[model samples]
Target: MTRHARSERLLLCDELDRLGPDRPTLCEGWQTRDLAAHLLVRENRPDLSVGRFVPFLGGHLDREQRRIANGDYAAVVDRVRRGAPAWNPMSNAKVDEITNLIEFFVHHEDVRRAQAGWAPRELAPQLEGKLWSALRRSARLMFRKAPTGIVLIADGRGRYAAKLPDAHGTVVLRAPVGELVLYAYGRKGVARVGFEGDADDIAALQGAELGIS
Candidate 1:
């Protein structure tokens, strides 16, 4: 898991370098520089990472992010490439494996799938299995605000339920686990996932707010 996470991080950094700082990414209103800074802050700045969940500190967090992002673009990417600093929890191998595997993979896809002419890369079967495991555990939280219950059907791998509270109905989304991860992360338009169920339920799930930042 650590190996996968580290590889994804390095690849993301390479993409940022290739695309340059001003290039647009899938993250709303954020350019490559902003995304790079976000990755850095996520791993290194515990103080601001808390603001991701606590609304009151968001302003301060945004301010600090902008300040960090103002550094040389290459330098910022280099920092991300170098991995989390020694004092950071993510610097611990086990913690990084548990936490950042999905984080980096999703963010990596955010940059890749956002660009024109982009295509999904083939992933190793083991990596896909790992992603599926993570999705099963996180599906509920990621889709907590979903308007309908979601049953994620990974082609040839079986199914897992996303138990959203107050769900009006259920929708089944079928795709490879890799694609399902993208859809679960709210990338419905680009994830290549297919839907089945009552039209209303499908529509509700498709349009609902899904995934965490």
Candidate 2:
């Protein structure tokens, strides 16, 4: 089977090259160059990648990211396009496919949807199914801190609920699985999802911090 994640990674790298380092992205405070550096660090630097979850290790990761970002922009993009080194787990096809499919897809949208005149890309049903499968394993964690119950409806597919133990009010978000994944990853303002619930609940959920680190 073709590795969709690999294709998305290359495509995103090309986009970074096309847009240049100064272009904005949906990732807070990250321009294209910063995003490229982040991808490189994520795939290559195991130590720094762990810092994504370990708070104390983050300062070093941030400094390294800055150093990478300050290097020649074209070279950075080329490195991202070339992907992780052979010894890195991410360089393994199976590992990259399972781990990076949703990652690259989301980051690709982060770049695409953050710019002017942006629109949703039409995705294949197979790709959508892959994304939904990944979301099933991850959605609850992403929305674990949500203020209210979250009912995610993958339009024409299925639903997944992320609810607090004593949660009362609920918010229903209906959208294609791809868009729902985006919302689950904290892209609320840009994700094309329909909200159904009490206005207060909706507001609170929308305003709350969502997504993994």
Candidate 3:
């Protein structure tokens, strides 16, 4: 579970190369190649903060959408690889590297899920826990002043959601952890996930909290 900075980069490149242009990704309007390009850009640019990253991300997203439209992911890959730079967003190489890991991990699975492919066998368990907390803790200000009884669960990582508000029994969801990460980002909903109970409600709750809906 001890994730290092360099390993995350290797994972990104490996996954992207492995995915290639023949696959589809979970990021809605993106093909495997397009998604790879988008991620390449993000990983390289970790110098920007969340706010700055948004604008930069928007441009890549626009390009990505076009790549998918043309169904020519190969071109997109070429464009990015030609003269692209790595602009770490977090301002902390070590910190941003972990963040980068989260990004690559989630997006990689996003693409795989869209194509019904399998997850990478080498995914790090250490990251699995942090990602869940990052998502739940992210909603701290947006949700209640403090966490109620909500027991936000993502397996080994007992992340935020300390405020359950009287909900009994953990709202268990048996989904690919990667999909769960995207869900946290408001990139998808329950329909796109494997679930147990009240899928609609979970989606609604997640959407409302994350502002996806």
The candidate scoring highest on lDDT is: 2
Write the residue-wise lDDT of candidate 2 on 69-181 in tens digits: 98999988888888789988888888888899999999999999989999898888888888888998898899888888888889767888867533548999899998999
RMSD of each: 1.7, 1.6, 6.2
Give Cα distance to truth, residue 127, candidate 2, Å.
0.7
Query: What's the TM-score of every candidate structure?
Result: 0.94, 0.93, 0.57
Instruction: Pull out the clashing pairs in model 2.
Output: none
Q: Which candidate would rank higher by lDDT, 1 or 2? A: 2
TM-score of 1: 0.94
Tens digit per residue, CA lDDT, model 1, 89-151? 788877777788888998898899888999888888878887898899899888888888778
Per-residue lDDT for 90 in model 1?
84
Higher-lDDT candidate among 1 and 3?
1
Off by over 4 Å in 1: 164-167
